[model samples]
Target: MKHLAALNKYFWKYRFRLLAGLVFVVLSNYFSVLAPLITKYVVNKLMLLLSPGTTHAFHESVQDPLARVLINRIDRWNFSNVVALCGVTLLVLALLRGLFMFFMRQTIIVMSRHIEFDQKNEVYQHYQRLDTTFYRSHSTGDLMNRITEDVSRVRMFTGPAIMYLVNLLALIGLSVYYMLKDNVALTLYTLAPLPLLAVTIYFVNQLIHKKSERIQALLSDLTTNAQQSYSGIRVIKSFVQEKAMLAFFRNSSEEYKTNALGLAKVEAIYFPAMSFVVGISTLLTILIGGFMYIRDPQSMTFGTLTEFVLFINMLMFPVSAIGSVASMTQRAAASQKRLNEFLRLQPEIRDKPKATPKVIAGDLHFDHVSFTYSHTGIKALTDFDLHIRKGQKVAIIGRTGSGKTTVAQLLLRMFDPDQGAVKVDGTDIRDITLKSLREQISYVPQDVFLFSDTVRGNILFGNPVATMDQVRQAAKQAVVDGEIAGFAEGYDTMIGERGVTLSGGQKQRVSIARALIKDPRVIVMDDCLSAVDARTEREIIGQLYEYLQDKTAIIITHRIFSLFQFDQVVVLDDGHIIERGTHDSLLEAGGYYADLYARQRERDERPSEEEVTQEK
Candidate 1:
């Protein structure tokens, strides 16, 4: 019932189809009730005519127009005409019942399929609107199952389970009403075990519900493990850890097997118990009705006894079907709970209300900005303030986790500062739409991720509408155009997942070209040149520097040569700026930068001499 109200919005749109299906179920149940009554009429009416002394009396008693015409056709007719009329009525009702049933099945199928499509699309669109930080804390497999398997469960429950329950209730209501009308005393005796059967089914359903939850959880875990193993298969193969990976998978499979067997054990017991209840109901019907008929054969007619027996048989399927639907509904409810939990979580970051997109002029500022990922007050950056004007290149140097990447993330609005302001073009970034702010700058991350696509497709990712000539120009600036052209298909060659067909350096170059294609006012390169050789790195940077001289650029790198080309450099140690000046001025100040430059120069002069090294 938690998400029931929310789900009903979708239900209302398809209410017409659902109403039509329900009408068919009612009509079908009505026809089924008619079968018992028709049988009773034939038995009682035929007995009177065939009693050996009432042939003329039976023919005179038929005063109805349809009956008189049939009776007039025969001389000394007994019960054959009456039997033939009942058969024709039954055949007509059967045909009409089949027509309604066909409509019911088709409408339910169409309604459920459309609902599934809408739910899946809604989930995907909602996921895109969520903040990137949400993805950082969740796995790919978990989200995949929510969209694939969880939506599937909702679809199945809505279609077959809902229809079956409606039909079962209709059948039970009509059957009981007719049974009581035939003979109240006989109905009481036959239904005496109904309460006991209901109680037993209730307990069995509760057991299955708990076991089914466990099985769903186990299935999710197994899916996560399999997805992770497949994504990291290259690492396993390279390290020759195939046997170890297999052992882990075998253990996960065993856990899945255990939970599945637990569910099976409950179902195995429940089905047979249902059958046993139906058997007992049958036994009671025959015993009580048979005794009453023998004691006073004239008091109880043959037609009434036949109707009672037919109604008892109808109860078998409804009771069993109700239990099956209950089990499926519980599983669907569990899946719905998980999916709603994800959809309700508010993203940690959002644009301000009434915020507008602002055009930036390439001037950036951080004023007394302090930040911590933890609301518990562990600071990642403290009182951080810096200014970079247009047409200036600034390089930041720091050890890993010394808050270097945090600077880039904060600038991109990945998270907001705990206290203080980050302004671009003299306007606070928090006051502008994120789309407008991010559009002015391009970021090349430390780790390059390429899709399974063509070389040209990857390069022009930032600008999909770019022409082929522009794509080639961007690739040429990245210094990998020649290498790509040598391939069998040149720019048309397909790259495997994450560019498995390319080397680390090649992938990094492709990432750089993607950023370059955007042609933004500012560029932030976070160790973007780490994988390439020195000569190629220099050539790429030389071409990039000429084109980027008039744009604001921030370069973070471990290479002293990469930093020397920048106009100004800032040295950060322990989340505090230790030195900030031009490349020559920093060396003249004889601070951290001076010492780092001296050590690097010595390394170039002599490889055998060992000295202090910074780990990043």
Candidate 2:
């Protein structure tokens, strides 16, 4: 009940709708319960009227105290007319019940959907606010299940479970009042099985909640298995590991199935436990009421007994629904706990209360900065210091683990440094609002990520309000306009997920266009030209130097010759600056940079066997 109480605010959000739906439920129940009372009156009339010349004493005490008034009218009318009148009244009540029931579903269940929509939006919005470190520590599949499946379970609790539970309480209260008024002893007998039924439901729900939470957790694992397999399908096929991956998926699926069945087993036991109690109460009513009726009709009359059975039949619907409500209640509790936990998480990298907003000039500095990844606890950069003047173009060249990308990450404030500060334009980056800092810089990483949308949409993703002319200019600068024009729908064509439909070079160029459209104060290109041909790379570089004039730029590259045009090149090895200079100066020094340049130039000059054979 406490778990359910947490959803009251969502219900209150649509207070008018919730009130209207419950009012309809009440009206529907009024009509439904009215039918049985009419049956009780008509039956007693038939028994007495058919047995003509019965004692006036017996006729005086009909089931209803107000029956004497209706009987005086009935005496003038024949039995056939009286029975037909009751039939018409019952038919009208049934129709009214059905009409209100429809409106009840429309109001309450539909409001639940509105709440669900709001809940999912809040979860997604929070995910956006969390820093990159949160995502690196979490799995994509697990996050998806939390927002989708868990929210759905909470919705069920808000809507259908609430409706049923309310109806159950109301029906039982109303039935108890009438039962006690008619026969206290019989009502006491009927309620005897209730406590046991309640006890059974309590223990059963405990089992249900425990198993459902486990099942939901296992479902997340299964989702992760499927997501990883599909994302790495190409690699699996290339390495001939299909069978191994398939076995892994099979094992995950079996675990999910086994846990699901375990929940189903407890659910299976719950229903019969409720039904067995219902059956015992029904058997007792018939047996006890029959003996009392035979002993004296006044004490427990035939019409009275029939009416009592009808009320019990009416009570059976909500009572029988207890099994389903219990199951749903347990599942909802687990899901609500899971969703609330996620919502309560505070992002570690959020801006301070008084963080300032400022336009950046992009004069960046790393002042003896040091950082280590949270998971590995090993320093990525230690006592590292560098400074770039505003509007300067600097290149960082490093091997795979030598921390080239870490520089871009720190500048973006994806994670705060452990020891020292990162500054932009004389102010520590921690003082700047995250939105203001990120908006001033454009980053194009080595591995491109494009949404499943049109090429034009992907390019304009950074600056959604950019015009067609601006879009075309950016595309041309990145050298992807010609390829886009050849597509059947041009800019409107749907590129598949992560730009899988495009070639690697085309994907990289589109990512470059995405960054170019931002028109930011600073730009970071992290090996973004690795997929493009050497000629295209050189052309892009020539165009960038002109188009991105006066903007601070960091170009991380492996092409040693490409470093010649840069204002400065800093070579890194094992998180230390190993070499620094222009191509001419480094060559004269005959250091690591010179050796790398000579080796790459020789490799390029050497022809392949196919070219050598053709020459011969």
Candidate 3:
């Protein structure tokens, strides 16, 4: 029930529909309780004809003075006609039950759908609000599981759990009222065995809750493992580790199965025991009532016994439903706790309370900024002080793990620096609204991620309202226009998931085009051109040189062909800025920058074996 506290907003929103559904449930229960009443009259009337003295005994049993008048409606009519009349009345009540059930299901079930729609989007939007730090610690598959399976579990509570719980209470209330009216002694006798059912259910409910939590946790791990394996299938294949990966999957899957089987075993023990307890109630009712009937029809007549037995049978569902209802409640509560923990996370990198929507002027500065990744506990950048005036171009060159990308990340405010401040136009980035700050910057990362959409759509994702001309122009600048044109549907052609259908170089080109379309005030390209060959890289950089003159740009790459185009070059080593100068000045220093430039030049100038053979 505490888990449901999070869903109060949704419940309040659909309160009217839920209220109407409950009204229908009340009407349905009213109609449902009428069947036993109808059967009671039919039995009493038949008994009156079969055994004439039984009716006078029945009159003595009830304190009602008009018991004969109420019980003997067919005194002037024959048995068959009266039986037909009772049958018709029963049929009409059954029809009304069906009608009310339809309305109840329509309002409640459909309201569940509406709640699902809103809750799913709310979770998705919360994900969007979360910063890169949250994602760094959270797995993709776990988030996916929370959004999909977790939402479905909560939705079950909204639909079947809610509908049945209320209806069960109403049915039990009405049935008890009618049963007590007929014979209070039998009603008390029927309830004597119910405490045993409640005791059994209480222990089973605890087991169900614990087992369900374990099963759901195992499922999250399994989903995360499976998703990572699929995403990294190419790595596994290249290393010929298919069997190894499959074995790992098998182990995780087997563990999940084992946990699930344990829960199933608990349910197996529970449902049968619950049914047996309900059966005890029925057996006790029949045995004692039969004895009473044999002794005297006045105390418990055949009609009253028949009606009482019918109501005892009705108790079967509420008793049996304890297991299913408990199972759903436990699963949903476990999922809710997981989802709430994630949703409750406030982003470390977000707009401050008094943050202003300041338009960036592109004067960037990292004032002795230092940062350490939380998971690794290793400093990615240390005392990194750098500045770039508006419309200046800067190139960052560093060895692997030298923190070239961390600089770009800081500029984008993906992860705030642990010490010192990153300022834009003389104001701390934290002082500016994240939307306005990020909106002014266009970043193209080393690993490109494209949506499963047409080439044009992917390009336009940077600016959804971009014109087709702008799209084609950005493609041309990235030197991918010819490839797009060659596609059968050109810009309309659908790309596979994450652009997996495209070659690596092609994907990089499309990513570049996307960033280009944004036309941001500040642009960051973090080793984005490594996939393209020397010739295409040169062409793309050449085309970008003119357009980027009026915008601040940061290029992070190992390649040095376009190094001279930048106004400044900064060299990083072990999270420290070891060298800083223009390309010529850095080469003159004859340090890390010069050594790296020489290595790149050698690789680019080296020819393939075919060219060497031709010379021979």
Q: What C-alpha lDDT values do all the predictions have?
A: 0.79, 0.84, 0.86
Candidate closer to the true structure by TM-score (higher is better), 1 or 3: 3
Q: What residue runs in model 1 are displaced by over 4 Å at the alpha carbon? A: 3-5, 43-95, 296-300, 375-378, 561-564, 599-616
- For model 1, residues 1-616, the per-residue Cα lDDT tens digits are 4543456867898999888889988988777777766676666666665564533232343223443454455424456765776688778778877887788888876788888898899899889878867887777777888898888888877788888888888988888877776567888888888798788777887787677667767777778888988989989999999999889888988988988888778777777777787778778878888888778655556667877778778768877776677777767776777778878887777788977899777888878888887634557788888898977888988777677777888888888988888888888899999899888889998888999999998988878888999888898999889999999999999999889999999999999999998999988888888899767887988888887878998887766664337877888776677789888888889988888888877866653323334321
* Residue-by-residue lDDT tens digits, candidate 3, 1-616: 6877898899899999999999999888888887776677678778888887654544334333333353356445777887787688778888999999999999999999999999899899999999887888888878898989988988888888888888888888988887888789989998898788778878888888788778777788889998998888889999999999889989999998998999999999988988898788889889999999999766788888888888878768876887777778878888888888888988888889999998888899999999999978989999999999999999988889999999999988999999999999999999999999888899999889999899999999999999999999999999999999999999999998889889999999999999999999999998988888777887888888977989999999866754347888988988999999888888888998888888877876799788899999
**lDDT comparing candidate 3 with the true structure:** 0.86
Cα distance off (Å), candidate 3, residue 599: 2.6
| Cα misplacement distance, residue 220 of candidate 3 (Å) | 1.1
- What are the candidates' C-alpha RMSDs? 5.0, 2.4, 2.3
Best candidate, TM-score-wise?
A: 3
Q: List the residue pairs that clash in candidate 2.
A: none
Two-way TM-score contest, 2 vs 3, winner: 3
Candidate No. with top lDDT: 3
Show pairs that collide, candidate 1. Answer: none
- Please give, for residues 1-616, the per-residue lDDT of candidate 2 as tens digits: 6666667788789999999988888777766766666676677667667765644333343444434455556656777998887788778889998999898888889988998998899889999998888898888888989999988998887789878877777667766776787789988997799999989888888899999999899888889889998888889999999999999999999999999998888888878777788778888888899899889766776666777788787878788889888888889889888877777888878898889998998899988888898977767887778888898888898788888888899999998999889999989999999999999899998889999999999999979999999998999999989989999999998999889899999999999999999999999999999998767877788779887688999998776745337777888887778888776777788988888888888987788788899999
